[model samples]
Target: MFAPILMSSGVSIQLQAVDYLILAVYFAFVIGIGFALQRHTRTSDEFFLSGRSLPGWVTGLAFISANLGAQELIGMAASGAQYGIMTAHFYWVGAIPAMVFLGVFMMPMYYGSKARSVPEYLKLRFDERTRAFNSYSFAIMTISSSGISMHVLADLINRLIGWDYTLCLVVTSVIILLYVLKGGLTSAMYTEVLQFFMIVFGIAPLAWIALRDIGGWDGLVAKLTVTKPDALHSWAGTSGTENAMGVEWYGILIGLGFVLSFGYWCTNFAEVQRAMVAKDMGAARRTPIIGAIPKMLFPAVVILPGLVAFALTGDGQGYELPTKDGVPNYNQVLPSMLLHYFPSGMLGLALTALMASFMSGTAANVTAFNTVWTYDIYQSTIGRGKDDAHLLRMGKYATVFGILASMAFAFVAAQYNNILSILQLIFGFVNAPLFATFLLGMFTRRSSSRGAFTGLIIGTFAALLYHGFSHAVENPLGMKGGWLAQLLGQPAAFTLGTELAQTFWLATVAFSVTFLVNLIVSLVTGRDKTDAELSGLVYSLTPKPIETHEPFLLRPAVLGSLVLVVAIFLNWYFW
Candidate 1:
């Protein structure tokens, strides 16, 4: 059964005994690391936040690795094939600056406050209402995100090797569940660090081999120019909807770059939780900046494969993009490339890497979800006044429940062809409004808790209404939005050219409404917390993080600046 065979989908790669050996060894190592770390997770703190003892580098890799899951692997390649180099905007414009901002500016407060989760920080800075809203919303988002990762992995395995989808999902989830249940967040982070290397080594070769097979960059470019003229240039024709991305400069910058990007990197607990677990404030501050280094370079391996796959199609070699329901299924591009290029030994390694990516992301989500559920939701409410031992026990229970919940959500992910679009829509509803609350909560002491809670509710509703009334021109008036428009018998408020563009605009609207409402409500409600109480949580009230003692190269500011320079250069080069 382990031996690969030809499938009805036309996938022809076959795995040998050596391939099974590689897979067995990888699974052993993953589970072994969890057992080894089991002793360290004796208390709630260790289980949830890794005892806040990890060095910058470990947390840094985990930070990026957690994000380099199905979204980065499958969704990104899909975007690259669909939109070409414009997909790089997700990294260059949407990720880098936010990471730098988190490291250099936000980490000081997040780390210094000693909050266990992002929602906990809201509680410290604002009131219980703000924290409760965020905690519930975040828990839902994390579980949904984890489910998407699970769905992607199961789909890949079933399509590639003819495994039953349900069997794949059960086996993969059990593996992830065992490790996380044994070792907690420490296990997850260490595994993420290992997975990071696996993903790099496993996937990087595909880019190089694909480029070589397509006759290098110049040849690929020439081929794309003949078929998709705008595929090679990042910024060309982006001034209006004439571009392949269906987004203009202002929308890209404000909607994606500023609102959606900052919202996720700065406030999303799954990514920020990795940084918060660092051994000290300095390590925490540098964690995201360090992660930003690899993040900026990831496009070469992740996005390039999609472009190569596109260019290879119709070259009279029988290569074609995988199709579902007579349309190109962009989500299969990366896995399809793996099947097209890798032999038995390399195939197992690459497949292991793909599995690792899914586990890394799923584990990250489960860990974050458990932490929030145990500390923010449970302890703060039903489990209030619980001792450390009780909380620790509850944390373990939360881990089990979180994974089960995620497994249930996997079926929901199957409804979409591109996972990233659904994820962005979710973020638009959750993260976009939450960022506005954080912006007001952290930056200004005058922002009342009432203001934050009120703004969040209104902003989230605004996003729902906006999404309901608008949709991409290509999508029908249904789950993708414009439902309210159809119901009201009015034209869509805005008809964009792509689902991604619609999500970006949705995020922008959410952010704008939340920001404006927060300011308005704060002005009406007046201050709630005193300056002394807000000292560590508020920017101006907090003391500057003194990093002078650290080596210059290791300083967060220095690292962030260097990352920004590299990011700018990449954008310029690609543009």
Candidate 2:
């Protein structure tokens, strides 16, 4: 009778024109900063790379903003609602090591190269087809991802502020795009610092209140264990194949580390834009890790309150799952939890934090997409004939275009309920070959142009087919079949066929086959290109200065490993 998220549960925090006015004003200020920075962005270099003058914190904050898209803010909480501590490993175990790897080995190569774009570097080392192929493929993913981002901010705002959902989406998106178009990356970076602070300040109190509401640490744990032991630690306690709790170790190592990290952090143009804008090589070098350090702790800060909500709502349950809306949806963990636990005025603040979390992602994506279209697709392609003045005008226009694209995507993305799952579907096809092609291009001088080109084409296509085919298997009847079907797994979740099947298996198959296919092609083609030519392409970028000592890597590595070990111990202990 008492659903935690029922319509009548709390006083509706009806939004006023003043609310929209305040948000609009903030949007104007962000856009004003961008327009003011146009003077600094006179050349293609400045427009694309912030003229390469950003400092450690500037680039570092933007780097964090780039990765902290709406999918992450909402998805982390969603995963927690279902999975538990095992969910946190996505960052602590997966992203941190990838960050450390980037700082020690990859960052040097990236900054050292002097290449404008990732694909440009590929072209230099391999072939034009490789460069063009990567450029376009990445562009599509970034746009789709960015557009979906707008909906996230809009969705959270609507839920938090109690406004018409469409109105919230429109108002939030229009404001964000205005600033993004105005100053481009400059405004985006500055705002990210404020956004990050806002998110932390907003979320911290709610978490404290939840813990206090349960009485204390002991009370909180005791209450949660009694209410939902499945959410307590392992998140790995799924009874059988349909279990959301049962993430395997092999999947963790590959799914997150090799595929996701390299895909998001390393190859993403949005992420690369952060490094490219850095003031110097030194700033660029350390900023990624500096940025990464806080992100590792994010799940703890963001997901804790949701667990508390589950603890409070149990038995016949206050709110089972969001069945009122649809099937097995997990996106409600934050909004539903906040509404139940936080008081009135504080609810507004919590709402702002969720909006800020989303805006950070929206603003970051808008800035990067503006840079990409202006630099890669538009300036390099369609508007190639224009002068500097014309190109600059066109560049600002590109931001507007990107904003519209994102708005469109947000509307369409509603059909799919799981934001993270949809994103992973896209990543399945593109992320692996992206990691492999770039890695080989940098480290191995023996790799050939034909090999690199063929590898990318073969790998990406294979991954796409793997995803489509696997999904087909997942629902031979169709995906509409709900949790009962999922548990029974008509097609199963992880396997082609089994006690279970997951989306991960196809990704793994795609990754292995593509890599092997590309590797063989590279070797066969290596004979045509002399070793010197290969090495030249590989080392064409200015080499980063090496210090044999890296005391920093040890701590993250140790910390990351400790988290993994403890996770396995807990899963085993609980089982």
Candidate 3:
């Protein structure tokens, strides 16, 4: 399975017989575990939410592991090389706070309500219309995101190993489908736990080897001084666009940290659904806190390779990134580094790690999609009063549909040359306003379902307008799409420098508009809920929750606070 294969790039995939054996055994073991758990999924609860029987430690790791997919692995590393250590902002500032917020504040409402999915929570708090809107949007988003994973895997295989793209896609789909169909959410989480370790084992060594090759931390800094002085400093030039990222600290904090971060970690069902499966409220609240630790450190693991690739390529060390049509492929940096450094057996393991990341991400999307589809959409709308066993079957069928939908979207995503751009655009449109809806629903008893529905629709429309106007500058209509830009007139010369900054700005505007719209409309249009009605749903109306009997150190507040302090220290240190 791991025999050497020559590629168009002229480097051999030097995977030996033992390496192939390791991969074969790995796949078989994963499938065996899935089959072993097949009987546990007879009920909808088991099939969709792992019977809500997972411990914090297990669910916590799986929580972060599910997110360590192609986007995190590929896009983050590429950004590290392109934008430098400032990319760490995505984790340290952007993720940790929202994650802690989810664990400490939000999980209570989510888990206490015993809602089957995120959309269901909205339905309970708002109305069925709100729930349907969210569920439908999320279903489309999950399949699209999963398809991007499939497209990424096929593209990488074809480019790196001279494999047939369609064949690779079929193989990957079959593997993911089998385990997911057999074991449901339980199996997906179990495999995610395993994939988490594989990601560490796969990428940590590459960082070590690359750093050693460059001499050490000191050596890396010294070499980067000549090749990329800007990349060496994370925050020094972030105040303006004079450095690698060209994004201001205000943009980084408000745009990335508060808006985009909260939007994703708090509202995105693919992530929130993981915590919803915890055995109890305590475990559910602790899940993201536990997940936050590894999330904060992963930048060092994945980004280091990208930084190293930059150093090697800059130094003419035959580590140049692959190109298509004379444009350099930054996404290939990690794989290129793996090929440049690892040999034979190690190479195979690294490859397996990449594949593991892809599958883990894809599985999470598929599982989340199926759960929401079955409980939120199918059962609530089409198959009401269904038995548990029947719902379980529906969940299985939804999984297959999710996978197939993703496969179809993968082909659509392939037509676009820039996957990251499209991904960010989707996130901006869907997540930014969704967060606004949830924030109002949870914090204030006055925000009615009408307000939420209106806010979501208008907020998403605002995001689309921003995106349209931003790109409209190049259109023949010019600022016609955005009369405001036309009123100010176009600049003679300028550059935003990166798509991220643009997306950040767009999401920020959308979020602000949505929050205000929700607030004003909610205040004017409806009666507020009584404290009795708002008990566990609204923050101010709810009583302080009783503490769990777990040890002080293991307690959610203690751990979450500690994680926050560590995150603060990292920002300070990096700054």
TM-score of every prediction relative to native: 0.97, 0.84, 0.94
Give the Å error, residue 409, model 1. 0.9
Q: Which prediction has the highest lDDT against the true structure?
A: 1
Of 1 and 3, the candidate ranking higher by lDDT: 1
Query: Candidate 2 residues 294-314, lDDT tens each?
Result: 776576677776666556555
Tens digit per residue, CA lDDT, model 1, 1-575: 33333243535456678878988898899899899989998999999989999999999999999998878988888888988898999999999999999998899899999999999999998889899999999999999999999998887888777689889889988888889988999999999999999988989999999999988999998899899979888887888889988889888998899999999999999999999999999999999999999999999989999998998987667457876666676777787788777777898899999999998899999999999999999999999898999999898888888888888999878877668888888989999999988888888888898889899999999999999999998888988899999889888988988887899899999999998999999999899888999999988988999888999989898989999999999889988
Greater-lDDT candidate between 2 and 3: 3
Q: How many residue pairs clash in each candidate?
A: 0, 16, 0
lDDT of 3 by residue, 1-575 (tens): 33333244533454568778767877887888789999897888888999999999889999888878767888888887887788788899889999999998999899888888999999888889999999999999888988998898888877777689888888889889999999999999999999998888877899899888888888888888898887776678877866666578898888889999899999998899899999988899899999999998998898888887777675555466555456556777788778777877787788888888888899999999999999999999889999988888888889888888888888887886557667766777789999999999998888987788889889888876676556322333242233345455763222355667777877897898888888888888984456687677777765655776787877788899999999999888877
Q: Is candidate 1 or candidate 2 better by TM-score?
A: 1
Against the true structure, whose TM-score is highest?
1
- What lDDT score belongs to each candidate, Candidate 1 first? 0.89, 0.64, 0.83
Candidates in descending lDDT order: 1, 3, 2
Ordering by TM-score: 1, 3, 2
- Pairs with steric clashes in candidate 3: none
* Runs with alpha carbons beyond 4 Å of true place in candidate 2: 1-5, 8-12, 15-29, 35-39, 159-162, 234-243, 315-329, 379-386, 472-501, 527-575
